[model samples]
Target: MRSLAYVAISVQLFVGLQCQSLPAKVKKCHYGDGKCLVESANALLRNFPKGIPEVNLKPFNVLPVRDWLLVNDSQVGGAWYFFELLNQINYGFENTTITEIRGFDKDPTATRIEIHGKIPRLVYKGDYLAKGRMLWFVDINSHGTSESDFLNFRFDLTLKVRIEYRNNKRYLKIYELVPNIRLDRWIMWLDNFFPDNEDLTIAINNLFNRNWVEFWNELEPGILSLFETVFLSLFEDLFEKVPYDDLFLADEDSK
Candidate 1:
């Protein structure tokens, strides 16, 4: 019966989406415009989780992981080119609720949303391929599987987003996302491998956590780029299901 209800709801949503006309393109909202965009954003976010229960990516979704410093050759006691670690992973969040939204009061250009929820689970199953040289011999086939998981994480993130519009659609680009992620109460597993030679998983984890700030600094660029893609995709997909006018306000409504 519960499953049937879910199917019914999904169908209703699909029908509702199909019936709505595309929102008309309006004048762009500028910084500190004191326009209706802010109010519209708030209204749209408050109605979240009602129509947007989950957001995810499939295993086929290419999550490119490049320029990641797995373990330098010197530290790993060899020459390791943790070259390209493509994550063929499927992950997302469920039961999401937006707690608050700020900065849009005057500056719609820089807006922030406070979100509280659990990313039900994340399955990162991918290949750990690399190349290394040890003892004058290069092991080009440094290959294995990399699997990780976080059963249920209770955390909050402050998503700083930059909004843009093109062709009648609102584009939200994440400028900075500060997460107060609490995985301490949750069991997170990270099982990375590199052939039968050695299991440097523990050491690798420690190195990254050793200097939290530096670690994030070294990887921020790559991380931010990945986030931009994910967020843009999510917003684009969202507007597809929900009408644009329903999410943002028309210029005249602002005043």
Candidate 2:
């Protein structure tokens, strides 16, 4: 009787594993159907904030970044700057809206997917260190807490994936990810810019805010690289647990 009970438990566990394929909330799209793909992708994003336990994904609403650095040695407005941020917490991705999706209509064997999206606002809080020289005369050195609010940020994401066979099922393995990001406006505040001089700190903050475009031009590369790393990890976690066949159903399969 004990041996028979052991067999029954084993069979139950196997059946449970087989049933845990994809999250129930995920709407499977037909292969090469862009409209359905968009809807499916949006549904997936909505689930990402709370996480899909079936796929073993974690909440990504607030992502933590260790550190990032930007250096502008070349002359720009008669000033050159070096900035570094540490222990950053980026917020607001849970509010993202996918404006367009492309390359999904390509052949199933194709390896590329392009996605465009916007985040109404992104808030970053971190510790910052900055050093710079202005007008070939004035030198600036500061380190303190900083907060930046980016409004109307848009991004174009490209994902490169390859097929892999696991347990006789096909799955997508994301090998590379690239992102192009743009911001419409920025609000920045840094504490202790001049160390105990409130007036200087306020002035410096205003200057940075007013000239944010130039600053963004300098920071864009670093920002893109950061997003590439973060999103790649996020996608890998989702794709590895889900089979390709489960994600995009064929027409007959949909029926």
**Per-candidate total of colliding backbone pairs:** 0, 0
**C-alpha RMSD of each candidate structure in angstroms:** 11.2, 4.3
lDDT of 2 by residue, 1-255 (tens): 999999999988865564346766568777667677777767777876877777766566877866887564655565888878888888887888887776643254463588888999989899998888878787778899999898998889988777887667777777778898888898999999888688989997999999999988877788778778767766787677776777666656753
Q: How close is candidate 2 to the true structure, as a TM-score?
A: 0.80
The TM-score of candidate 1 is 0.45
lDDT of 2 at 59: 65
Candidate 1 lDDT tens digits, 1-255: 999999999988866544344233323343333334444344443433233333221122233333333443443655544434455454443223333334433333544555444455544556556566645555545555665454554555566656555445444555666555434222222344334434465655455455545655564455445444544454445534443344444546643
Q: Which numbered prediction scores highest in TM-score against the true structure? A: 2
The lDDT values for all models are 0.46, 0.78
The C-alpha local distance difference test score for the whole of candidate 2 amounts to 0.78
Q: Which stretches of candidate 1 lie over 4 Å from their true place?
A: 1-83, 95-107, 133-140, 160-180, 185-232, 236-245, 248-255
